[model samples]
Target: THIFGKFKFQSKQGSIEDYELGDLIGKGAYGEVFQAVHKETGKNYAIKVYDRYQMTQANKLKSINNEIKIIRRLDHPNLVKLFSVHETVTNIYLVMELVTGVPLSDYIKQK
Candidate 1:
């Protein structure tokens, strides 16, 4: 499934049973970011799904993995928290804290 010039594909290995995926909130080179709700806790999170094919093509798999490792060790109030990680044969899901604030560029422009 392709949406707005972005490729949308389902994961074959990961189970999304715990998450109720909502609208496509954002898009990037690797994949799309979806607003997801945890079924058990009713907590909202931003699930960034990275397509395996795209990551491989960009040679970003190792970089992404390294990023995850670094994020897992972070506990700062300013940083978006990394809650969990889910991997599929076709995609990787990064469950992250949903932060609300003005974009840096927008803030700069206003100033």
Candidate 2:
């Protein structure tokens, strides 16, 4: 899920090399979000890449897993839709419906 840069993500399903990451849209304490595209399908997505090593605590990992489940099931027009989840030894990648607007970095900068 390190595709936020040039890293490749491998899951049981397959390599996420199908998509190449574009500009970063958001960054946080643990991870960053990047816009990505499917090479074959030409579809766009917002990929949330989480640094697994940063959330090494058991409780934090559990919380992340729980959040994945919750986001996967959520259906809302305003919220990003979870399209897929891919995890590796280092990161967790959340493939989501791309919604454009303000970047989190800008919001944080204003605060």
Candidate 3:
């Protein structure tokens, strides 16, 4: 069973089963973010999937939870809006607005 990159079908929060997984758009220290489409709505979203093992080892549990709390309240054009949260035993998923453009890191480098 892979903990990284792979998504789990079983869940309690929101089910990843609702979304059709697509190519990875970005990655962080804990996991990767992928482009996903709602199986029912046909709408695209960016799903940030984090590995629980890496998050625990990196000690990001508190910060990650805090970020989720803060991000949920925020709504802006510049910010990617959070739609829903999903979790399986091994991974956490954040479904967010799909903002297409150059990667922020690449854009910063170009500037």
Candidate 2 residue-wise lDDT, 9-72, digit = tens: 5655346667899999888777899999988889899888887888775446667677777886
What TM-score would candidate 3 get against the native?
0.84
Stretches of candidate 3 off by over 4 Å are 1-14
Q: Count the backbone clashes (under 3 Å) in each candidate.
A: 0, 0, 0
List model 1 lDDT by residue over 35-95, tens digit each: 8998888989889998989988999888887888899898999898987677666787888
In model 2, how large is the Cα lDDT of residue 29? 78
Per-candidate TM vs. native? 0.78, 0.75, 0.84
Tell me the deviation in Å of residue 17 in model 1.
2.3
Q: Which candidate is the best by lDDT?
A: 3
Provide the RMSD of all predictions against the true structure, rounded to 1 decimal.
7.4, 6.0, 5.2
Candidate 3 displacement at residue 50 in angstroms: 0.5
Q: Model 2 Cα displacement at 104 (Å)?
A: 7.3
Q: Model 3: per-residue lDDT, tens digit, 1-111?
A: 423222235545347889999999998888899999999889999999988888889998777777888898888788989877766778888888998999988999999
Local error of candidate 3 at 62, Å?
Answer: 0.8
Off by over 4 Å in 1: 1-15
